[model samples]
Target: MTTTTSDGVATTRPAGQQPDPAHGPGTATRPRGRRAALRPGSHLFLVLTAAYFMLPVWWLVVAATKSNTALFDGAHGSMWFDDDVSFVDNLVQLSTRSDGIFWRWMGNSLFYAVTSGVGATVLAVLAGYGFAVYRFRGRNLAFSILLGAVMVPPTALVIPTFVMLANAGLTDTRWAVVLPSLLNPLGVYLMRVYIQDSIPPELLEAARVDGAGELRIFARVVLPLLRPAVVTVLLLTMVAAWNNYFLPLAMLNDPDLLPITVGLGQWQRLSSVGSGGEQVWNLVVTGALVSVVPLVVAFLCLQRYWRGGLTMGGVK
Candidate 1:
């Protein structure tokens, strides 16, 4: 049916039909103009956040290109490069400096990180599985205490840990750093929560009925299922251990015992008080750049684990 108004514009409707106000069927929906545009605050926030993080990294890269003389000569902006990029040269020097001690620090960092990540993951898995499956005395209370301990800054424990190590004669040794980092309260808590939500008790009971011992059940059944959570605890604890500074700083004294974090810090301090009493800015910047590479590599290599772990950790 068709109707013509007094102004002579015609409207049409078939019998038993109604017009929908939203849109014509053939047209794609469009936004209501400015409201759909990026909000100024969000855009500004993203830009600021990007700059805040990337600025220092940019400066590190650019500064590696310039000689130390150009740093404070007002030659260019902090993030801008001078005519020559001595970055490769600096990298070579960094490798050979002090009998290639940089590689030793790098190896030490790896040893500490891998050792800690593995230890933390295994401990977390056991503690978490125990918390989820067992009914023991003071279980909840113990868990609550453990979770509470996570809130206490790890840094606050450094001095006490150092003192303990000193008495135990572990000071200035690899054990001083690695032993302390082995157990992470946060990782344990996370594993507990993950296990409680992800693994059903019935599965373990069934596994037991099928003639599996505790360790066998854990290895053959639970480990595969818990891989994602294990990865999460491993990655987080690994990053924590890799980026750790204060504990190692407080625990170990010998330069040979230093991890990259402490070693780079040593270089930074040396930058300020060379034989000539002036900073070696080039070494500082180059060392900073090189030190971050392993961290980047670790993340890049295991990024898939991180992504999958997060996805699975949310399972109920």
Candidate 2:
């Protein structure tokens, strides 16, 4: 006999035999629904992971609001705000301290990060597109070298970079920082992989067939599809440039050219000196809090592109 199952699929069975539970109509749907459900343990793990990451940020926020005395005294403990709320005072101190040099450091960081990030992103996109699309001599060999470069730790190269910059008489200048920051092998690799996976060669061929030149085809067709990867690489390069410490430290000796990372380190070292040193921990903490705001804003602004990319990938 034939009967319609719950999924509307018709099945045949013997006259007196019941449907087999293993091959029942709703069995497939049941497993799918079950697979979608999260167990209590999974929920617990997610909550714990979130807390682990957020706890330090929470402490930083609370510490930023506390007075120097309260910060060291543990009066309200470390995780909660002190009653006095010196956040405004800290900002004022940060603004006026050292002839408002903190703002200069911030401006330096902004310049380095933006210039390097844009340059790096442009290079990565171009190189990645070329690697993904065109078949050139030594393409695989060049990519292999790039992959090897990515495996080498960036810190390992700082000394050699400093030596090179010194040889070129570029040390202690902004170029020393910006120039080194522009070479992001990992970003290039990421873009290459993303382009290969997301952009089809047929689309480019179609654009060419429609009488589009290489430049026009890239700008009109390929670039629009590369938004997500572009944003990702931009953010990564910007953050890397902004947070760069060792390279800048080794390269720049002038206080006026220091980025926030090295500037803060200077303050920290001064604070650590025994009796003759000044204690500017409040300014340091406040400066750190302020430095983090730009990056957080960048992430918030660019997060939609990431979500959209994931959604598009899922659809494809």
Candidate 3:
């Protein structure tokens, strides 16, 4: 009845040659070969989704290898190249373009992503911890307000935010992007739920009896326990901040202040008009590929931290 998957998860398979169609509609199963445990349709959807996502990426990979001319050659398969490979040349060009300003934009993005991620994570954790641990007056009311904020779309506030930032004379600066992204209402809510379920009250009480200050207790006792939720919130916030397009587009008029997202848009617009022509499509494709790398790396590298018993401390 028990079969181990590649990742070592033990799954239960029923004893039958034919699938139990009555078990559920569109959900089928069989006990044959590698298909013994795997539901018949499990892999079909997964493979389809994988192909759907990877197609454009495959195209980008192939396209990045070709010159602009090969890109426009209609006879060539969209996923294949028939011309000179210039991935290296394009990368070199990308690196050296505009007095090496691409690197500057990259650094700015890293700074914004890292700083805002850290700040947002900390605020989320503390706020969530407070919501979980403290029962002050209006706690539910305050949490309800946070839940409401989560429902409110961020784009709806763009103009009002712009007006406020303009009034404060903070527009066209890195702070303009960094400041707004630091507050994640959903992240705060998520942290609260995570802390409530994962953090141990007894542990906090034990620390308090031992004369641990709130901040000290958090640093030495709670943080290590909340690592998974912390990683989850941090990664989510980082991706959000890094991919933020509209906020930056509205606040930053100066090209120097633009993040890669906005900067890439500029390239897309410019490429449409000049020698880039149809070839500029590759830049957009290539840029998209490059932009996704950091997020993938972050997820892979930090996934371990996000896997532990994040609710161990919060449960009764």
Candidate 4:
């Protein structure tokens, strides 16, 4: 069939068919799009990934509430809480163990993490900005060294670092742990990349034209733009410092100076040895749970910055 409009343009269609104004070809396509959007394997993978990460945390929470006997007993499932609620009792025991030294370990961890995190952030920003913005002698060689440093396993350098610290008479001191954490090559590299991509050179030129010095330009202009990268380096260095084990173990023999990682290993050993008929399994479990709380809280508090860092820092 054919029809003519006022403009005398002819159209053809099936004898009894008319076009629906609202639902054209899209009516058929919308259903296909909806079907294509829902992938069973993708949903399954997401569910499994979430469970894989969450199950250990759930076990920790459950295990913290149980007594050592219940924790080891086959009667209760590891995924759920037993009838006994011993979190408060475990806290008391953990606090009093070794004359309140566990709290001291916690304090030491906080100090090291915060101090090294700040120092690493500062140094990384300065070095990375310089690498990205400046032209200097041996610039490529220096950055190549940094990238090579990133590839070297930190564990491989622990012995050398310990020897250097010992020679300087800084072994067994808080500086032993903190000083090593300040030189994060990965942080410098990340900052350099972030600055190169996100910051415009014209802005720096304008700042320089207005009589702003390099330090002033960095402190005022570039730093604000690098907030995401700075936060990223801060969190990475802090987590590394907090969870550090081998360096402190190699450097310090003093129990009072030990971070939670080494200190908890001591408790774990004591738990296994059953020295003086005292079992520390409960204390170790509780302490592990307690130790994780700070990092979790930190992540929650600064998660917005973390998310922004992922977007801006090319981490995603």
Best by TM-score: 4
Residue 42, candidate 3: how far off, in angstroms? 4.8
Clashing pairs in 4: none
The best candidate by lDDT is: 2
Each model's lDDT comes to 0.76, 0.82, 0.74, 0.81
Expressed as tens digits, the lDDT of each residue in 1-316 for candidate 1 is: 2346458975432211122223432122435585578699998999999999888888887888767777766356776887666778787877888898888998889889899889988988899888887899999899889878878988888898888989999999999888889868877776776666567789999999999998899888887877766776788878888889998888888888798889988777766754454576777778788778767777677665564444433232
lDDT of 4 at 316: 27
lDDT of 3 by residue, 1-316 (tens): 2446568985433212112344521243343475557675988999999999989778877877766666778346778875577788767667777776676777778888899999998999899988998899999999999988888999998889999999999999888888898888987877776666557799999999999998899889988877767776787788788888999999998877778888888878878765564435666656666777777776666554432222222232
| Candidate 2 segments exceeding 4 Å error | 1-42, 304-316
Query: Quick one: how many clashes does candidate 1 have?
Result: 0
Alpha-carbon error at 139 in model 4, in Å? Answer: 0.8
lDDT, candidate 2, at 311: 32
**Candidate 2 local Cα displacement, residue 2, angstroms:** 40
- Per-residue lDDT, model 1, residue 168, is 91
Runs off by more than 4 Å, candidate 3: 1-35, 38-45, 273-279, 301-316
Write one digit per residue (lDDT tens) for candidate 2, span 148-260: 89889989989988998899999999999999889988777777767776687899999999999999998989998887678767777888898889999999989999999
**What's the best-to-worst order under lDDT?**
2, 4, 1, 3
